[model samples]
Target: MVETDKPKQHRSRVLEGMAHAVSQKGYGDTTIADIVREASVSRRTFYEHFSSKAECLVALYEAASHNSLKVLRDAIDPAHEWQTQVERALAAYLGSMQANPVLVRTLFIEILHLGPEGLAARRRVNSVVADFILSMVNGSKGPKSHVLSSGMATAIVGGINELVLEYIEQDKVKYLDELVQPASDLVHAITRT
Candidate 1:
């Protein structure tokens, strides 16, 4: 029987190496050889782990998003007010993005240059974020606005995503807290009946 655990472990190492390589070279420019070389594995090993560079990028994106979601959830206390929770979540996401700027850059910008597979992966990430925001707003303290809910949630998520992209582009995360209120306000405005 094939050793499943060995393949899983090798795939993980390849993913880490791809993240490192892309963080330096970017997604559009990175090649299979670049990944395998940085990973210190042979071409066959790279193929064994991933079918293409796009797959590696998608895996990298999934890993980063998963980690950021955990950080965001941990940043808020369950007992806090809805707005406070929003602020905490935003702060956590921005903070994590700032800390791992390379990951954010590669996942957002570089992934865009790839084929349909990468785009689909990005859409999946966006859908996950959208769903999370929807759940949070729907569960907020006060009454919910069914009519504006979807647009409001999309706006909130899009705004935060753009702000994070800007932070990564500028190489600075100054005034992350300042962004929270405006983001919250935008959400409120959009959702208010």
Candidate 2:
């Protein structure tokens, strides 16, 4: 591999190893050895990129969150009706989650058990999502009387997270797209009022 590609390859392997390790053993029970073994790398190689498993998990979560946000952003269309945009965004968000159930499960479930740092990461991701929703709502509101507030945007993000969590807990992740209509409707009601 090229010199620069080495770090990227190692990081990708570590993240993939994290997903596999967590999926097999649960994040709480997985160890550095398990991750290294899963990645087919030495312990020293793992440490070169991450100080600890928690840090690795945070990196995994951040990468996934960034990719998901890109999907949501790309799905938006200025020419579309606001409600349609909402539906499309929600669908794209859920679709990305559905495409990566292992990572999604680790993110929405396992990462929560990582304590304060994990919570902070989760909140940071949620804030990004909320900001995206807020921007979409603001852009589409135009001169409409009803407008969504920042607090409302946060609540909406929380609500959508809850909905996704429920589906994940039920082992129905494939049905995530089913949430698009309800989520869009919720946004519609909140934005119209």
Give the per-residue Cα lDDT of candidate 2 at 25.
Answer: 90
TM-score of each: 0.82, 0.93
Identify the leading candidate in terms of lDDT: 2
lDDT of 1 at 156: 66
* Model 1, global lDDT: 0.73
CA lDDT scores, all candidates in order: 0.73, 0.87
Clashing pairs in 1: none
Tens-digit lDDT track for model 2 on 1-193?
A: 6898998899899999999999889999999999999998889889999999999999999998899999989998877655657777789889999988888888899889889999999999989988988777777734565667888999888888888999989999989999998888777777773
Worst 10 contiguous positions by lDDT, candidate 1? 142-151
Q: After TM-score superposition, what is the CA distance of residue 40 in candidate 1 from its true location, in Å? A: 2.8
